[model samples]
Target: MKSHSLDLKSELLAANAMLRTVIDENPNIILMKDWDGKFLIGNRALADLYGTTPENLVGKDDGAFNPNTEQVDFFLKNVRSIMSQTETQVVLEESTNTTTGEVSYYQSIKKPITTADGKKQILVIANDVTELKRVQKRLEESERRLNYVLDATREGIWDWDIPTGIVTHNHRWCVIAGLDDNYLSHPLETFVGLLHPDDSADVKERLQSCLAGTAPYRSEHRICLENGSVFWVLDRGDVVERNDEGVPLRMVGSFVEVNDRKKTEQALAMQSQLLNAIFELSPDGFVSFDEARRVSYVSPAFKRMTGIDFSQVNGLDEVAFTDILVDLCLPTGKFRGFDALRKKRVTDKSGGREFIEVVHGGKRILEVGLRSSEASMVSQILYFRDVTHESEVDQMKSEFLSTAAHELRTPMASIYGFAEVLLTQELDAESSKEFLSIIFKQSGLMASILNELLDLARIEARRGKDFVFEVAHVQALIEETVHGFKQPSWREAPKLVLPVESLYIKADQKKVQQAFLNVLSNAYKYSTATSQVTIELITTPFAAGVGRRIGIRFIDQGIGMTPAQLERVFERFYRADTSGNIPGTGLGMSIVKEIIELHDGEIELSSNAGVGTTVTLWLPLIG
Candidate 1:
């Protein structure tokens, strides 16, 4: 009996020791309070909350260390009530650790218990749930935001249970499909039925691919409605749940109407193609650069104008591209190379550029313009336009102004000098008469030049609109003009060679007579009195585009002109003979040429220095 007692005592002590260890090491708050609210058995967790050790907390109430007197009172009341109860009761309590300054939420189980000493007590066990409560709040907020987004978008939503083959659709889906809310069918069958025949197979393939995890479930397709009308939709979803073996169990997605967006994209694509065609065919060239200042695009015209192919310059950087352009272009004012232009752009702090003239090769002139791109990716735009013809026109205008002024000044100077001499000095009648005659002749020459200029301007501006139309016999017209000509008494009349064939022309009679008189007068004015001028009527040979033409040839035995002079013989105010002795306005041939051309006739002249001059006026003959 003694050994048995000793063994039982050892077993009991070990059991008590294990229980003490289990209670002390527990993470949850565990304690026992007597009816007087004094802590009887306190674990390490409960003692730590009171800022005391389990050994030191043996007969102590929370009033010693806990800062809340109200909390202590409330707990004492609960302990008294629990002490009276026969069955266990539960309560939740909150506590704060003064040492750690940590607030904690706890789910506490309060139970009434009887100690070995026959004292009534309350036992409390609590687990901290602060992190779990915080997590629950966060989840609720996230759910609220997601639901708000869904409501705002108003997109058609669908959920599919892969394993059950069950599908659920929102009311928006039915509205989008033009179907009643009560409509029901197999989900896959309804989906396949709504797809256009052309897109059905591809959509199914892509869906299967998505299921196989090869690609994403994203597709744009046309959906046929109840009335045979079709609209485009962007259908997209992803696997929301997967089994442990990686099989898709659920998918969630939405449908959005993209009909208008698709149509706009198609129209923009067609417009882009048209612009590309224009760039390819245009004479102007363009170059585009990327954000890195590398060449991004070169139009076909750019390659043709610069003789550089995209294959040669593709992917070239700015400096390298500038080198290529420098090789192809001759420098203009303040522009040494493309790099210099880039610097200038930076200096000016502007994108707009003036047209810079650069000579490409020997004859071609190119005007270049540049605009810096404001887009984030594309950097700048460069354009080249061929302005060679416009440049030539500008140069010709300058020359015309200079030459016309020079010619007019000569006649004015002569008239001014002679008139000033007559005004300033008293002279004999013979000398005064000579100066007056000089002045009179110069004034008349100037008047004739001014009149001819006005007539030429009027004819060109009207383009034959002011002329009277008539038909005249070519031979009769020539004879009448020569009869009216004031033949210089010092020069003999031109010899006439008449044709027997009767030839007629459609022309303005006065204009035709005026042309003949000018040519005949030039013949008399430019030749020596002994020089024989002959007018010969000959038929022009048959030639394409020149129907049966009658040629009136005027052959003059006068001082002829060189090839250089012949080249500019038709120029206004240009004279083959620049000597002061030649008494002519320098406008006779120009006037004659203009009138003949206005009548749809042509003139041909041939001459050699000191030999003779031959001129033929050809007009279309009316049979």
Candidate 2:
């Protein structure tokens, strides 16, 4: 019996030792309070919090240890609530002041306990939650600030889950699509369906390429909204989350509105295309240079006009280009340097027109325009056109007006002098008849001059537009023109030299006859009565590629003109015989020259001062 009691006592002491070990080494505040709010038990944590040993707070209330009355009262109130609760347990969040004057938060769980005497007591267990609460507050603040920034920028944010084909987008994403952002998760089709049909394929291809790692994740494409309006957006993203195998798992990106910028770019592109079309269609030459003065562009007309290989001339300095143009212009005698071009102003007021004469297949007068490109400040532009024919016509008109005035004055003076004498002075019948005859002759001369002038003007003005061009035997046309001069009163007729075979040529019958008549009349007027003008047919080269030309030669043995007078023979109303004895208007040779030129024929006249004159005419023969 004695050994049994000893074993029981030993077991009881072991159980009490384990209980003390658990209470003394606990990490939490473990304590108990009576219904009166006096402490019945205290652990090491509670003693440490109060800056005292567990024995010091064995039966003390919080008021005995804590100096702050509010904390003590709060602790007592929680204890009383737990003791009074009919329920099993109660939990409360409470605060306490430490010995270091730092306030820390705790989650306290309390339960009512019945002692052996059947009195109710409160048991409290508290856990520190100060650091956890502080971290949570900070995170909430950061999230709020981030959302604020995103909303302010109105950025459309998207998070795509690759494997699931699901997407989570922010409120702004739906707003951009003109939809309500009531839900967060959507199918990938929700966004993809909004792409314009024209851009859908390209966007898909780009996205697939990026997802496959063949290209970067960026795109600019057109997207259609719910309102049926299309907008341009620039989408950019990166693989934010990837699997362990290096495959993309998720992607996050943004969509930025770029419609205005895209419209501007399209406008510029259309303008560029139109500008190029204008350059291509223009008959005039165009050249442009960049900021470095390098040849940036050359039109097709410019290449043809200059006949310089653009490959060789492109990127050359302005001086080199000038040298090339000057060399091409050497035959035309209008060489100019780059300095001259630089000196010209490029404004509407100035027009910047400069004449550059160049001989390509023929003499060409270039009216070049210079201007700076407003689109690019450092660039320059040049526009050139061939104006050779226009310039020559203007000069011819001016000369005709001057010479006509001079030629008409002589006959008018003669008529006036003779008529004045007949009207004012008394004379015999024979003298009066002689004076009247002179007046009639002068009037007839004036009429002839006016008629010839009118004929030349009409022919030139029509310029073959109304002429009937036909293929006729060359020899027949010559014979027909010679027959008009076959009058019975002539001292000698021109000798017609014929070719054994017939030659055909394109010519107008009446104009050809008129041309030959002027030539024959000149031959007869300048030569003596017995002089014979021989006409001959011959062949010679026309131009570079044009085949043989038919030549008709008219040789005269009359008093010929000096070199000075010969040069002016084709001038309208310019007569070699300055003494008014010649009975012809000086417009005959000019008319003859114009008619020949209109037929695409050339005339050559060689004269000796007193010996004779030789006139040869060349016309292109028909095939």
Candidate 3:
């Protein structure tokens, strides 16, 4: 009976120790406080939030640590109400750190509890939501800005599916075009039918030219309604999407009503305001020429796009203006089309030469268009549209397809060669099994490469939109990753040297774990059994700027890479040592880079030919 009593006491002590570890290790705050606002229980996280220890918070209330008495009173009032409740309640609670004055938000679940001593208290479990709140507020601000832009412009936005000849319009389109609310869908012919007889042919020609890529769609034409009503509108559009055959797949544009605007008292004021908004907000740059056909005004976007300021080019003729821009463009870009308008006056209403590609600084692709007439004041306008992203997308797609084909063919050839050898030759059981094994391994390698390619594609396309981001404690994540990691050749496990202070980040737990696992796996895979792999939290700044990232560095004493190999580490399907002994799909580092960059993080690596390699992942700290 005495021995049993001792064992029970031992079990009770063990349980208490486990409970303490659980409470303290949690990043979230957990605590219990009595109805009088005095603290009864506090975890390490809750104490740290107050810049104190748990023992110091045992009997103190908010007033003991918080200097903001009003905020403290408000908090205590809520605590009292929560303690008074009969059932559990959920609320979003906010707290401010007295030491740093940093505000934090939490989604807390508070439950009314009765302690073992018959004391009534409130138990709280709070998850950090400060980052989430910040993101939500930013989204709200962006939506408000978009609302103002759309409402202020009063333009009807429309998208056209060229292949299907279907048109979709914003709500404002109907009022501008004097259309009935009867149609759920409108065909391209519906819009074409509304064009005035005199203007219909010109409009068709412009649309055809835009579709053919000979000219951009910009026309002011009269619209004829069914009731014999006529109105004028500014119609502008661009082919936003195209297929591999260079055929347009989709076009998006806008319509602005200008019917009888010349007679309105507010016409000049409205046009001036709209023009100012365009010059300020539009991503496309514009350069205006006066009656003398000299560079008179340069939009802000023009300066940003071409680095040519109005002050520098004001009162300059066409020849001088083109010279400045041509200097910024490559000689091979065939930017000489602007010479067509060098001699023409501002009143020359003919179609200025269509878009001629101008490669800016050999990095950006700009499509330049010239118009002889814009407004009465501005006689000639030069428009510049940056097509760099579109151009890169095309190049990327081409490279992806070609690279995938070349990489996949190697494994397929092995599979085919091995199967052919097995079928044609009369082999013993051992040889047949070896051949079959070879085939199976190659097939598995192919699957891995395909899966990696798909993952890379999905990541690039969505750009972290599908990520479920949350507060991720780095130490716990690394421990979890290393605990499950293993390799046949790696005799020793990777050693972890972590910081004493907690390091936290907003991350997708699974993705970050995958990234850690990949890095650790590479460290072990490339190294010999006796080689050591070490991981530690680096407190130093990885980059310069405010809110710089913290590094989680992994160092491996393995067969390192040469400088040439290191340069291509993040290239898809690149292997430092392609010798089949070091097995890999070669896409691991590339995938790691894409994942890190999408998370607003960076990966830095250094290696020597005979020495070892060190990889550091720089991630933004949140808590």
- TM-score per candidate, chains pooled: 0.52, 0.48, 0.52
Give per-residue CA lDDT, model 1, range 415-448, as digits (tens). 8998889899999999999988888887887887
What's the alpha carbon RMSD for model 2?
A: 40.7
- On residues 1-623, what C-alpha lDDT tens digit does candidate 3 reach at each position? 23543444444343334334334533457666777877765677788889999779877888898887887898788878867778766677678898898888876666665532245677666766675542221100000000001112246888999999999887788877777565425999999999989889999999999999998899988888778877678799999899999999999999987543311313333333323533454456777677688887777867877677789999998888777777777655646646664433244553343334454344677766665553345566777766666667678768978988998998899999999998899999999999899899889999999898888778776779999999988899999998888757438778889988998989988888888888888988888788889998986654457375678899998899998999999888888877777778888888888888878899999998778999999889864
What value does the lDDT take at residue 447 in candidate 1? Answer: 83
Task: Give the residue spans of candidate 3 off by over 4 A.
Answer: 1-267, 289-296, 311-324, 338-363, 372-380, 423-426, 499-503, 540-550, 621-623
lDDT leader: 3
How many Å off is the CA of 494 in candidate 1?
Answer: 3.7
Tens digits of per-residue lDDT for model 2 on 483-567?
A: 7686336566778888897888888878877887887777777887777787888877556767778988888888898999889
TM-score-superior candidate, 2 or 3: 3
lDDT of 1 at 419: 85
